[model samples]
Target: MKICLVGSSGGHLTHLHLLEPFWGNKERFWVTFDKEDAKNILANERKYNCYFPTNRNVKNLIKNTYLAFKILKSEKPDIIISSGAAVAVPFFFVGKLLKIKTVYIEVFDRIDKPTLTGKLVYAVTDLFIVQWEEMRKVYPKAINLGGIF
Candidate 1:
């Protein structure tokens, strides 16, 4: 199945990378920020760079939404998965509208609190995965997948 992996740079990207074993052999491409770590790690992989300064930036959110819709339409991914920062929001939203199955992994660091992106995507994601049991309290329906790393 074709998969679209989406996430931001730094810790979010690192968390998603830990799932390489699952998607590496599959037909998958990535949507992430243009950062040194992402560049080095995904050097040989197929990827698309999303806008930076995400989160609260209204201008980039609109731009990223357009980019996400364009990518999702062309890629025609069967599933879209993400471990987010902010960039994943548009992808997940657009993917949902396209009837693409979405899986969201809550960031590993936020054990006690919910992330803004996490809260937003929770409603639309088909499967919500959390690393810590404590997170389940916040995302009651979330399945504790232990830890990606």
Candidate 2:
């Protein structure tokens, strides 16, 4: 299956990277920031850099939404996955409209509340995964998969 792994830089990127076991053998690409960590981690992988400072940033959000349309239309990935900090919102929404499956793994640290990205994409996510059991209360449909860390 072709997978589009989308996330913000740093922790969110690390969270998705830890799932290499599942995506390693698949045809996959990434959508993330063009920061040092992302550049280093995905040096040899296919990656598309997205707009940043996405939290409460309307301009970046609009820019990313366009980027999402462009990338999703071209890549045509079968699935879109992320452990996010806002950047995944546009991708998930676009992917849903394009009939692509989406999986959002909530960050491992948030136990009591849902992250803004998680809450925004939950409705469109095909499979919502939570690292902590308590997060299930915040996201009733989330599947408790323990932790990816």
Candidate 3:
């Protein structure tokens, strides 16, 4: 099945990469920022660069939303998975509208509290995965698969 892996740069992307064993062999591409770490790690992989100002930037959010629609239409991924930091929001929203299955993995660092993106995507995601057991309290329905790393 074709999969679209979406996440921001830095730790979020790092956490997603930890699942390479599971998704590496699948027909997949990535949606992430064009940063040094992302560039180096995804050097040989297919990817779509997402916009910046991820937090509260309405302008980039709008741009990313448009980008999401285009990507989803062309890629038509069977599933969309993300370890997020805002950049994954548009993709997940658009993917949901397109009836694409979505999986959101909570960031590995947040154990006690929930991340904003996690909260926002929780309702829409088909599966919400948390890396820490304590996080289960925050995301009651979340499946605690432990740390991806």
The per-model lDDT (C-alpha) reads 0.92, 0.93, 0.93
Ranking by lDDT: 2, 3, 1
lDDT for each residue of candidate 1 in 35-108, tens digit (9 for 90 to 100): 89999989999999999899799999999999999999999999999989789899999998999999999988
Q: For candidate 2, what is the lDDT?
A: 0.93
Q: Which segments of model 3 are wrong by more than 4 Å?
A: none
On residues 1-149, what C-alpha lDDT tens digit does candidate 3 reach at each position?
A: 99999999899889889898989889999999999999999999999999996998999999999999999999999999998989889999999999999999998889979999999999999999998999999999999998777
Query: Which segments of model 2 are wrong by more than 4 Å?
Result: none
TM-score of 1: 0.97
Better of 1 and 3 by lDDT: 3
Clashes of 2: 0
Q: Which residue pairs clash within candidate 2?
A: none
